[model samples]
Target chain A: DVKVTQSSRYLVKRTGEKVFLECVQDMDHENMFWYRQDPGLGLRLIYFSYDVKMKEKGDIPEGYSVSREKKERFSLILESASTNQTSMYLCASSSTPVTNYGYTFGSGTRLTVV
Target chain B: EDQVTQSPEALRLQEGESSSLNCSYTVSGLRGLFWYRQDPGKGPEFLFTLYSAGEEKEKERLKATLTKKESFLHITAPKPEDSATYLCAVHSFSGGYNKLIFGAGTRLAVHP
Candidate 1:
């Protein structure tokens, strides 16, 4: 089975501190995505990487950034965490367009900014 | 712009009750529609994909159908274990890539 592992299930960070959420997929998928889930707003894409060292900004990439140094690892970074940035973060991987083959998602990491 | 809307923000059902969730979308060209189930504190899980109008797929007690502008996820004889947030998303060509637009989701609760 395809597995997307997130480094932490929960995290807490102080405001203005840098935060990193890690995700690793074992399937060698070509596409990786980071999204933040908030109530009533649904899932909003933060950033996505199509290939190693390549990235694209999603709709809500203002306060976040991403890094993809290898085929299996995708990392989401918060340059300066704030209280409003507290939410559940999800990572997903797919071989192509998610609509074509669907996506395998990590369990998610709930980040709390204080 | 591609957009998706799911209706009846929340639903409560008794065991053995049956109902359907609605998802409506507008896009330049509909490439695919997807249904997902998400438990509390977990990532959304893929359920079904509808490629075109008149297409239908079934798994156990869940059935998904698509039309020209909408999709419906039918739940039959729902049980407590079936309670979860059902999300709908559409894939459409945008800015030279197929991007997914998601709806707010329908939260379903089943009582025994």
Candidate 2:
């Protein structure tokens, strides 16, 4: 079975603090993604990494950045955390895009900014 | 622009009742349509992937069918444990890196 693990399950940060959310996949997938889930807005993609050292912006990438220094790990960075950024963060990984298989997601991290 | 829409934002059913959830999509080219189940405060768990319009897949009491413009997930004789938010996503070939456009999801509640 594929496993996608997130470092923190719940987090709280100040208004201007820097936050990091880490994700690691054991399936050796080539694609990793970060998404934020809000009450009415489903899952909004923040950033994605296609390969090591490669990154791309998604629908809502503002105020966020990503790091993929290795194949198994992907990190989401909040430049300056704000109350608006407080939400559930999810990480997912897939082998490739050419197949019909969907991504395997982590448990998710609920972040609260005060 | 690619879009995915799910209907009947919420549904409530008796323990043995059966129903279907709808997911409609519009995209340049379809790569895959996916069905997922999400419990409260957890990430989505993948259920099914439909590749073509006529394709259908099933697992236990859940069945998923796809058409040209939409997909349907049917639940049969559902139990209380079957209650969860069911999400639909479409991967378009026109986009880069196989990005998926997801629907807001339909929350299902089954009461005994």
Candidate 3:
């Protein structure tokens, strides 16, 4: 079975603090994604990395950045956390387009900014 | 622009009731249509993937069918544990990145 593990399930951070959310997949997938889910808005993509050291901005990428230094690990970074940034963050990974299986998502990290 | 939309923002049903959820979409070229189930406080779980119109897939009581512009997920005789939010997403072939555009989702609650 494929497993996507998140560093934290719940986190609380103060305003202006820098935060890091880590995601690691054991399947060695090539594509990793970060998304923030809000009530009534669905899942909005923040950023995605297709390969090591390669990244792309998604629909809502402001105030967020991502790092992929290894094939199995991806990290989401919040430069300066704010109250408005509080939400559930999800990490997912999938193989390349030709193999095109749906993403396997992490349990999710619920981050609260105060 | 490519877009995805789901209907019935919320649905309430009794155990053993059968129903269907709708997902409508518009994309330049369709790559795949996916259905997922998300329980409260958990990540969405993949259920089925339909590649073309008239394609159908089933898992237990859940059945997913695809059309040219829409997909339907049918639940037959559901149980209380089947309650959750159903999400639909579309992948566009025109877009180089295989990013999935998701819908807001349909929240389904089944009471015993």
Candidate 4:
């Protein structure tokens, strides 16, 4: 089975602190994405990388940034965490073209900004 | 604009009772529609993908059918283990490289 592994399951950070969430996929997928899931709005994309060192801002990328240094690892960074940034962060990777394959998501990281 | 909507924010059923969930979408050019089951505190698990209207797929006790305007996930004789939030998302040719548009999702609870 394909696996997307997230570094942390839960984290608490002080407001304005720098934070990092990591994701690594074992399937050698080419596309990786970062999304934040909230109660009413569902999952909204933050950033995505289609290849190493390549990134695109998703619908909601205001407070987040991403790094794809290697094919297997994608990381999401919060420049300065805020209370509004507290939410469940999800990482996903897809190997096939967007039209043909759905994403394989990690277990998720629940981040709380105080 | 590309958008997706799911009806019945929540549903509760007794064991052996069956029900259906709905997902509605509107996009410029539909590429695919996907169904996923998410357990609490866990990432979503892929269930099925429906590419075109009239397409259907099934697994265990779950069946997903898609139409041009919407899709339905029918749960047959559901069990307690089937309780989870069902999400629907759409991938379309809007910006050419746009990400999938997701709905709010239907939270289903099955009682034994």
Off by over 4 Å in 1: none
lDDT of 2 at A47: 91
Give per-residue CA lDDT, model 3, range A1-114, as digits (tens).
889999999999999999999999998799899999998889998999989999998889999989999999999999999999999999999887424457889999999999
For residues A65-91, write the lDDT of model 2, one tens digit per residue. 999999999999999999999899999
Task: Quote the positional error of residue B79 for candidate 1 in Å.
Answer: 0.6
Tens digits of lDDT, candidate 4, B36-75: 9999999998899998999999999999999999999999
Per-candidate TM-scores read 0.98, 0.97, 0.96, 0.97
lDDT of 2: 0.92
Candidate 3, residues B60-104, lDDT tens digits: the string is 999999999999999999999999999999986544666788999
CAPRI accuracy category, model 2: medium
Write the residue-wise lDDT of candidate 1 on B2-98 in tens digits: 8899988999999999999999999887888999999998999999999989999999989999999899999999999999999998887787776
Error of 1 at B47 (Å): 0.6
- The CAPRI-style docking tier of model 4 reads medium
Query: What DockQ, between 0 and 1, does each candidate earn?
Result: 0.71, 0.71, 0.64, 0.72
Assess the local accuracy of residue B54 in candidate 2 as a C-alpha lDDT between 0 and 100.
Answer: 96
What DockQ number belongs to candidate 4?
Answer: 0.72
* Model 3 pairs in collision: none
* Each model's lDDT: 0.92, 0.92, 0.92, 0.92
